[model samples]
Target: MLNIDGASKRGSTAGCGGLLRNSSGIGSGASLVTWISVMPTLQSSGESLIYGLTFAYDRGFKRIVLHVDSNVVVHTLQSDRDHSVVGWRFIQEIRRLLVMNWEVQICHSYRESNACVDALANLGCDHEPGMRVYEQYPTSLSSLLLADVMGITTPKVTSL
Candidate 1:
């Protein structure tokens, strides 16, 4: 299973991150985090999703279950036809990758339920523009990863 996420500050930097977990919700020790610099949040999200999928394919993963928090990105990917003008290239690339004889299922997840990758995305924003491939789990993500593996849910708070 893969949980992917993207982060951006409107007038600052942007980045994307993803985590590949096994059935037990433990990191497979293969993860991605990168800074894109100066892009809209939506673009960052789409790019991250694309990067995650491509990474999985390159690693010879034939059956993948992708979890993302952006509804727009998820909807665009699920459509058989593309109607995006801003992210046309990414949409096209994702389509091409999806047809590579793999069983890929993309699903929507709430942000709170996806804390590990979210933390990674924020970490990307603090770094220079580049990508990092990790073979071992980052120490920072240990607690959040544990929560996910234990099925712990974070309570949501809303402002009045």
Candidate 2:
């Protein structure tokens, strides 16, 4: 599944971050790509969210499970509401983009559980013109190391 989130510098954080998890296999073969964007502030709007989603889609992600802390974005995208503002043009674009064999689900997640993305976001906020990417095995020890660097506790290692 592909999970996406954003961070902003002005809001006690740096920028926006996104994580894409490839869970198409079992055990150690899983791959993940994490993306971080450094922006001036968090823009919880359709345009920014669409920008992130489109980036993932353009990169060949088919099935996506999006996680965001923005109620404005979640509600706007999930609800059947009328869009009359020009800014919401992106919302319309997002709706159109949904029909392209890509299943999109947006939900809310607590900030604490979203630490990796949070760190990426903060990194973006702290470093101007910031961007970072990690391609790794989500179930491997190195994945745990990457998670640790993000301040997330590594899961208990279990042997098969």
Candidate 3:
């Protein structure tokens, strides 16, 4: 289980993607890749996380390790109080999801290390708004997925 990523372009579109991997670091054939209409990036990010958790729960996964690229979202999940009124409902939902008996851990991940899902998220931005579930890695994302599985790091340059 991994935290899903949501990408949005200038408020025009929002997309999200997530992958589930076994302890061996190989894909577990449970992945969610899709996009929705324009929405705030934070909202999309939160929604995607919830979506992933829900899927895990429905599938009877008792242990899950989720990774997200947004520190704000991670912090919110760890905090006892909600910070954003706009995201209050989502925050509550996340808290409820966490209350289950399942053992779940959520952590932050750098975008560079999460390139595979990032590319899938970008793919969502280019397509129509809907959800697409993948039992196995999609052919379109093979290169990036392979790199992630191989633990190959690509240079990441960020502008301040």
Mind giving the per-residue lDDT tens digits that candidate 2 earns over 43-119? 52353356567777888888778777666666777879954575466678878877777888778766555555555
lDDT of 3: 0.73
Ranking by lDDT: 1, 3, 2
Candidate 2 clashing pairs, residues 3+ apart or interchain: 7-15, 7-16, 14-122, 14-125, 15-121, 15-125
Question: Per-residue lDDT of 27-110 in model 3, one digit per residue for the tens?
Answer: 443343322222445467767777778877877778998888889989989999778798788889988998898988988888
TM-score each candidate: 0.84, 0.65, 0.84
After superposition, which runs of candidate 1 have C-alpha atoms over 4 Å from their true positions? Answer: 27-42, 158-160
RMSD of 2: 7.4
Stretches of candidate 2 off by over 4 Å are 10-14, 24-30, 40-48, 82-90, 136-160
- TM match of model 1 to true structure: 0.84
What TM value does model 3 have?
Answer: 0.84
- lDDT of model 1 at residue 60? 77
Best-fitting candidate, scored by lDDT: 1
- In model 2, the Cα lDDT at residue 74 comes to 69
